[model samples]
Target: MHSSNLRLEEPIRMASILEPSKPNFFPAMTKIVGTLGPKSRTVEIISGCLNAGMSVARFDFSWGDTEFHQETLDNLKKAIKSMKKLCAVMLDTVGPELQVVNKSEHPISLQADTMVVLTPDQDKEASSNLLPINFHGLSKAVKKGDTIFIGQYLFTGNETTSVWLEVDEVKGEDVVCMIKNSATLSGQLYTFHVSQIHIDLPTLTDKDKEVIRTWGVRNSIDILSLSYTRHAEDIRHARDYLSKLDGLDQTQIFAKIENIEGLKHFDEILQEADGVILSRGTLGIDLPSEKVFLFQKAAIYKCNVAGKPVVVTRVVDSMADNLRPTRAEATDVANAVLDGCDAILLGAETLRGFYPVESISTVGRICSEAEKVFNQDLYFKKTSKHVGEEISHLESIASSAVRAAIVVKASVIICFTSSGRAARLIAKYRPTMPILSVVIPQLKTNQLRWTFTGAFEVQYLLCFSSCSWLPLPS
Candidate 1:
């Protein structure tokens, strides 16, 4: 997988990133991840978000094209330079989900209780308003009495509306579903399974692979969120693809748990991926609303035990209006932080929402407040544990540093190192003290952005005695 072209790019000279002191001031144990979209892609907006406490920038490829993503990457780099923040970038793949193919720009409205035919063809023109699907074996995979969700994707905006359908009949290539309710329609390749039928689909599409090879090979991303991950093998497959890319050694794989199959193989997938995302919107289609949040809690607990990055996503729904979050929404954010989720991801809220910055600030305020009352005994859980069992020097030092800080009641633990291994190990202990880690080679600093949950900051310090250098703006 190694590309010569990828290997040729000169490693960024360390001298350019050094600064006297740029404080990393996020004091909460949890981090905020804001997704980029049409609304939040500008350099000004992205820089504002990073300065306002957004630690990770997520780009979901499920909606945008390659050109759109490249623009986002460009803006994010500009923002990174503008804010002098080493924010991590997560490029999420579309994965294997079914969608609808609407050739017409106008949404052909369908009525309630109407009978419609579902075809798998994408290019075939529709007749009599028959909807076309992207999956070829759609009829074969479904049976009568099976539930089919006929969803509406608003083209004018990111808002989605959909109705349920019960499979009434199937004949050869056509599967007929009766609409349980009315819905507007406009989207691509839409489908969600209500049953336990997991199709044999490629983990990554051609487009997904292309992005990884191009952007990943070019060192444009920090992490890749593999979509629709059903098995641990899915994570392995994605990593297999990334292994060949040059300079992408730092790019980690994050598995997204959005379907029933993914949940079933949760532990295995969790261990395989760098982190996991509890995607509520997609999970809701498979499970009841109550069950979705319940699973989210359990998922968070499992990830904590494994010492991995676990994020609870799609929590704020009303932010689309740019209005203050409802009481329940506000409570949801606080609860997720209290539940030990390492991060809370804002989806449409930061993208299309009228108040993107306000939403980030709101979540930051809630998380900071929650961390103020966060009980270490309850959250970290003191159990009879093993220590110093074949631990590396860096790991051992991190543990000792954390203990020293706590014993002296030190407010901040400062560690100067070449790599971020010491900082990561300190984070694993869930220390009470803020970690101000000074690292070399800016890439390591960026990777460490997701390593610690507490008030952790990575300041790049490159001493180029052999070459001239300029410190970052004070």
Candidate 2:
């Protein structure tokens, strides 16, 4: 009777439609992605990292072999299970990187007036000690006396009457070739007047396709992080390959933006891509410093408009590898979160850094704090209307829908749009609830990767008739 009375003492309350399980807003938890490496390969260590804050772990395909990668992936899975967290594995590939094979043990230093030869020698690992400057086609594209940079260090002279070069005594393995002449580096095509033709690698290598297929068969990987993506064709081919994987034809693919071509074909890439990662390290070498910031900002705004989740990669400062991040670096991290990156990536910082725990914790703190400001501006903004429609009508509908989602305490607000215009407008209102925007086949859908700083749950439900709004997952 005492035990029965104790059971009967429990209060019973009727469920209410408007009742929300939790009042805290801002889309559940801020997604934190960390790259997996030697330092954090152990199951316990990886699990600790996941508990600390990492929500995603990227497996770099450019490094370890398949067997090693599989072992590591299994360890990560164990960690995820032990911690009881929903973690996603991202497959990062080594894209088409232009590298010079170097033969010299030490980096060759170039001093001004040092004549160097540009060769077609496959054996040569680095730039030659001396070479014949091809100025016959100087006026065609590259002129005399043009300063060319090799990797991040050396700068050689251009064509002049004498081809005399003051080379900076440089020393390094294969360095990336950079030309500076002031003729706007637009367009994807670059005419390098060299004796040897550049190597054109396949968008998806056989081994890469195999690993992607492995990802499908395992069903452990939730997201595919494609690196060095050059164009829409690359995304299309990747999608096709993924579709063939045992179980991954439908897995989410996040295109990593690290090259100029990828940026040029931003809209198309975004449309074809399921998500995006703004990898800054490789991108720094790919684009000029002045342009990188502006380009990143533009991508962010565009993604915001498209409602795709953008991941800001390479947040390296001293803090990433060191125990404490620099004040400026801390601010940089905060600014990206403010700029609307859905998540930020920690590469060597958490993988092989001295302070993986500290780095993860600090980044999480910065994201949490920055989100306050982001949320303030997000919820207050007005909705965008189509050209022919009444602005007031569109704005009113969007605001009302967002408010309804918020009051109902829905997990996600599902947006069904043919043109994706309604979703963008609704996103601008930025309800506290997550907005799962579903769009038909269109170019604008591709650009959404540049929009909101989160994930894009793309469902190819191409709306031929009706449009509706739904809530994101709780």
TM-score of 1: 0.81
Alpha-carbon deviation at 438 in model 2, angstroms: 18
Candidate 2 lDDT, 78-196, residue by residue in tens: 99788865566777865653333343434444434335544344443443353222122222322334334333111111221112222222322211222222121111111222211
Q: Candidate 2 versus the native: TM-score?
A: 0.64
lDDT of 1 by residue, 195-268 (tens): 55676687778889988888656644677888888999998888877777765655678888878899999999
Cα lDDT, all candidates:
0.68, 0.56
> Model 1, 430: alpha-carbon shift in Å?
2.5
Clashes of each: 8, 50
Give each model a TM-score: 0.81, 0.64
Give the winner by lDDT: 1
